[model samples]
Target: MTLAIERPVGVFGRKDLPDDWAHEQVTYFQDPETGLRAIVAIHDTTLGPALGGTRFYPYEDESVALTDVLRLSQGMTYKSAVAGLPLGGGKAVILGDPATMKTQALLEAYGRFVQTLGGRYITAGDVGTNSDDLDVIGRVTEHVVGRNVAAGGSGDSAPMTALGVFQAMRAGARAVWGVPSLAGRTVGVEGVGKVGYQLIDLLIADGASVVAGDVNSSALERVVHDFRGVRTTGSIIDLDVDIYAPCAMGAILTGGAVVDIRAKLICGAANNQLAHPAVERQLADRGITWVPDYVANGGGIIQVAGERESAAMDQVRARVEKIFDTTVEVLDTAKREGMLAGAAADTVAEARISSSRARRTSPCTR
Candidate 1:
């Protein structure tokens, strides 16, 4: 029982939060043999159902994990609402390096914890988790999404996320450069993982030259082999390109990276892109158009919340296209009102949340 788990309750003032937030269900799992710890945080269910992803990382403290789950869950709520999906927000964190600590027993333990929610929170892949990990979680709870293709799930959330990012990039490009196509534009992509690799492929397909970087040598090699106009680098942030796509972990655009970025548009599937609120303003001052992370990377959740798996591809593409429209609208409004892009997106999402809450509580609806 660390103070981090108790901190959210204190800040939200148990009585002031939504009924579901008061409970703030969190399940912890510890494997005696492997000495591994994991926690799942379910935030609210005011919308329809709780949906989020399981991320594995080596967090320095329990508080970090707690804060991540809380913020990510809340972001999911805003993301779902803005994306026009009928889902709530939740997140699971495994406190270890996935490369070494992930085991079948550990995944099963995590799955059982998800089961404790009794279908309230659905789990998917994030950060260190992948379709293979989702398959393991699927063993315990059917509430898992992004499973392997053979398992009847959309194993490729990266492409859908990349699609959304590309769409947002196009909107930003149109607004700033007044270009209808990404052709002849140089885009730098960070973290050539599943999502980044797929995004690079899409960008190259659309006639955009790509410069990418990742710690994974194999992924970088694959990028080199697949596309001819691709360049690989050691550092992600230093690449001088038109658009900087951060498909890796969150908070990469911090104090230094923001200053070093040569891109005109900042958009990617990475959640919580800004290390601090001031960074958004920094981006704005630099004339770097930013597509809010939650609004831009919401296609994965939209695809999962739907009922039919067969039509998930079409729905994801459509939602990604919608993300472009939303980004353009938000950017335009932000420019007109002298506000930041993140603030504009937040305003739109918060309005939706407030309206949805009112509708849910209305006497006629009740």
Candidate 2:
């Protein structure tokens, strides 16, 4: 099989790096034998070691992969900070289609690449990767989380992530409608994959009128079969619903799209929901309560971090539930300070990160 591999060569100074190269470190690994090309980016480690999932995808080229990893890694740092977790942000991206190119040797080779970083970066599961993939990566590296529960790791993070988003939705309801309940509300969910399916379950249980859609027909079918009364729509964003939850890919809420959003609230498990910073202001001007994506979907990282700390399941759930309070805080701050929700979230998260850095550098009071 011929692989469209592009090995990034030459030394890149800070000036030569991409515009989004605000990361602490960015390393590329290529194993010609196993046809494995990966990029691991560490954005920060002020609180502790960088922890994030490894995304495996078939990108068009190296530039796209770099951009994705940079954005995702930075988002993780903010996610952990807002969630009050003691983790920094990092991410890994494998440059190939998992379906056609994944193999034991390739995963193991990637694991070895992770091992070279020592304990500075921890690997988990993201899109196109799962607990089983973590299991394979764990074979060659100790710095892996979100492995199967049977394998003594945190297992899948999707359920926890969905739970966090659900809580965020509840908080959104409180902020906008003055009620902390989803009952009698109509929520439009985009993407019924791992996290979205479980979120639909929670919404259904809470008596919310659910209108869901997914690009994957099988995923849509599973939700339709499992949940009665869940209406499926071809266009979730355009649906006349109280809340629009984006659980699939990122940047769905672009400038043009925000103008047409009928939903009063936007809360979802997807990262980087706003394509540009300007979109945050647009949502605010439209009077839509937008839960910052990282703050809303941080439960998965909290779960994996708990597993790393050897915390119990109850502990993890409690931490995940705190997303509700965080959501409330971010919204309240945004309203009070006359700032956009995304800006408010960044303020809150950056405060925590900045405090950590201060404590680390300050001389000890002996």
TM-scores, in order shown? 0.89, 0.94
The C-alpha stretches of model 2 lying farther than 4 A from their native spots are 1-21
lDDT of each: 0.78, 0.88
List ranges where model 1 is wrong by over 4 Å.
1-23, 33-36, 307-312
Number of the top lDDT candidate: 2
- Tens-place lDDT per residue, model 1, 1-366, is 001122343324432233443435667778787656877777767776788888899987886776677667767877887787777778888898888989988888788777877888889989889998888878988788888888878785777877877888888888889975789898888888878888888788789988988888898999899878688897767567888888887778786778888888888878877876778878878888888888878777767665334665776678667888888888899989998888888788778767888998999998
lDDT of 2 by residue, 25-128 (tens): 88999999999999999989998899999999988888878767877888888888988889999999999999999998999999999999988999999999
- Residue 149's lDDT within candidate 1 is 81
Whole-structure CA lDDT of model 2 = 0.88
User: Which of the numbered candidates is closest to the native, going by highest TM-score?
Assistant: 2
TM-score of 1: 0.89
